[model samples]
Target: MGLRWAVREPQLGDVRSLVEAELACFEDPWPPPFFISEILAEGRFNRVLVEPAGALVAYLFCAWQFLDLHVLKVAALPVRRRQGLGRTLMELAERHARESGGESLTLEVRPGNLAAIALYEGLGYDRVGRRPRYYANGDDAVIMTKRISG
Candidate 1:
């Protein structure tokens, strides 16, 4: 049988695993301190998908700003990609945002990240704008937003 995975709200103890996953997934990943701060910050919703053995395979970080929820970061371990964990994390983030009274959810993705762009688009996100040179490596960012409905 295939391994079963579960998603839950992240705790302080999961910071290390989350950071490790981030490093494995991103070329310019956020440092461990950033994960720590985001997980501990007020108005932030952090979720993690864990394997049966308690290894974190995916994570999503988002923050509620007034009526808007901003997706700060999301990633799945390389071995766990294309298995719907990213979609699951995004769904959880949307639900949390809606429950928090958010009217919309916004995120920025690199123009070169076709997989992420396709995922957001498939989830009903629309491209709203672009930010030039948004990344440290001079990649432009594509800004997308999805409305939250009751």
Candidate 2:
């Protein structure tokens, strides 16, 4: 049987597993304290998808800044990729942003991440700008934004 996944706000107890998932998903993962701070931040929205057994498989971190919802990170474990979990997290983030009176959602992604770019574009995010040599390895970052409608 396939695993059942549930998406919900992450709790303090989920930090270890969330960090583990982040490490598995990203080349340069955020430190555990970053996740902790985001979860505790007042204007931030953090969600995680977990299996029935309580193993965190994916997570999304975003924050409200003025009229924008900034997507700081979103990732799914390698074994759980391409299952629409990232899209699901994005939808949740959008809903939260709209509810909080955000006018747009924006994110920065590595220019070479075609799959992520396609996903963001498919979800209505347009390339608005770029940051030269944004990553530690000197890769340019593409800035994308999607306007939110009430």
Candidate 3:
């Protein structure tokens, strides 16, 4: 892990690269407008991990729902996968959420995405339920949640 990096909110100017990250990580990618809306939403955000040169390393888009933080999307570039970038971003998200009055962190992952499942589990999240036909490809989404207690 590197000693220093930057995690900041995605801006309108970064939509193109954010969309590219979405395309690289997901088969059903979100469009530019969706990113725009989230970027403008109060308390909702698209956070990015960037290199010194400002290239995207990984990103996490989260939605604020009541007292919970829902992870809408998260991904590291294919070449950057498994380098703890995702974990670092997640840790930062958790701390910020906790400070922002969030009681829990929640997310949905495709049932077939074992790596993501493992990562969430390792982060103290537990399977809470499942949503059938959640994805465009008809994959079930495994819902996971972790209560935040300090």
Candidate 4:
């Protein structure tokens, strides 16, 4: 194996660590059962970025429906922020979605999350819509979408 990190489907053992990372990344982290239901229960497509030593550095969860992959959440360890982990996770999900017959990716990010918005924008995601008071604190959500194929 090369020095590259491994990004793959998340296993059961990743729930707690992934939740911790999510908590660090969001003010209102998702509950444990949410992860279990979406990822481990086969209801959704989930992937993680793990270091060579088996540490989960990042993750992305998507609700795959028809040809659309709705990104529920993507997060990396707080200490690992700004290191392109989020982008790497996005790329992995995009590749997986394409291989799985998905034609587009969509997500809703809080308007206040400038970093995440910038990341998505840089990756070709554009604002397609908005949801009023979509966040826990009543912040608007900027809905973004990227079409991966014609």
Candidate 5:
């Protein structure tokens, strides 16, 4: 079988699976109810990339307002990391944001996450600012933004 993946709005049923994937990738994963709340909230966007067998392999969450798309979270399963899944999910978000008249997509990543910095940089995101003590352990966050003109 060949690899296949697609991004779609996350379902309530996928929260547990997404949390599992998040746990695999992060030392601090959001609780299941948090994902549920995002999915149920207005002006928020949450999507998941399902594998060939319908497993949740990756997820991206963002909050939209006016011309801004603020990416709140994203993660891929350990087995899917470095396999282009994250890039694909981000591209999907960019396309959606542009189509929705978003002027820019913004995100903050932990300063120590070199892999994520490289991924965002490679995808045309520039480091625009920083937030000190942004992460749970007081790690600084490198703010990045990619303009996707409407």
Candidate 6:
């Protein structure tokens, strides 16, 4: 999955919508247990963006790995694509990473996903490496990283 920025803490009620959004955005979706687990994963910093009516708009599920914040899954709901949500999320993620004493923000995306790649590049994340056959569909993953300034 590639996408999201969060404004709300996910609730048990938000899991199904998050799952649905994940299913909607990704060809190979993660199982519900991951979303379920996040509801109580206090040590983690993942978050969801929800509408005032409680609809899930997007989410950022990331893990702090050593000195870097690694974005595991990020996606906006299909209807909410563009309009700067991805940029907001990435900018916020970078800020959070820096505040948490991180040196970089990192993520992986499909090489064919030019829109997402463009977004990452526009945000200063440079392609640094590649993981061959990274997706279930056998697509190679392009690794991108942005160094955070204090």
User: For model 6, which pairs clash?
Assistant: 3-74, 3-75
Tens-digit lDDT track of model 4 for 77-132 = 88878888889888877888889878999999988788999999999999999999
In every candidate, how many clashes are there? 0, 0, 0, 0, 0, 2
Q: Which lDDT tens digits does candidate 3 get at residues 21-108?
A: 8899889899999999999988785688888888987888898898899998888999898889888878887888888878999999
Clashing pairs in 1: none
Off by over 4 Å in 5: 1-3
Q: Note the residue pairs that clash in candidate 2.
A: none
For residues 1-150, could you state the per-residue lDDT of candidate 5 as single tens digits? 135886689988888888788789888789988988999999987888887789888889999967889999888888878888888878878988988888999999998899999999999999999999988988889999998773
Winning candidate number (TM-score): 3
State the lDDT at 118 in candidate 3.
83
**Please, what are the lDDT tens digits per residue for candidate 1 over residues 1-150?**
135887788888998887777788998988988887887899888888888989999989998878899999989899988999889899888888877778999999998899999999999999999999999999999999999864
lDDT leaderboard ranking: 1, 2, 3, 5, 4, 6
TM-score of 1: 0.93
- Regions more than 4 Å wrong, model 3: 1-4
Clashing pairs in 3: none
Error of 4 at 43 (Å): 5.4
> In model 4, which regions exceed 4 Å deviation?
1-4
Q: What is the Cα-based lDDT of residue 54 in candidate 5?
A: 90
Regions of model 1 farther than 4 Å from truth: 1-3
Q: After TM-score superposition, what is the CA distance of residue 127 in candidate 4 from its true location, in Å?
A: 0.3
lDDT, residue 106, candidate 1: 97
Q: State the local distance difference test value for candidate 2.
A: 0.88
TM-score of each: 0.93, 0.93, 0.94, 0.91, 0.93, 0.90
- Candidate 4 lDDT trough over 10 residues, lowest sum: 1-10
User: Comparing 2 and 6 by TM-score, which wins?
Assistant: 2
Q: In candidate 2, where is summed lDDT lowest over 10 consecutive residues?
A: 1-10
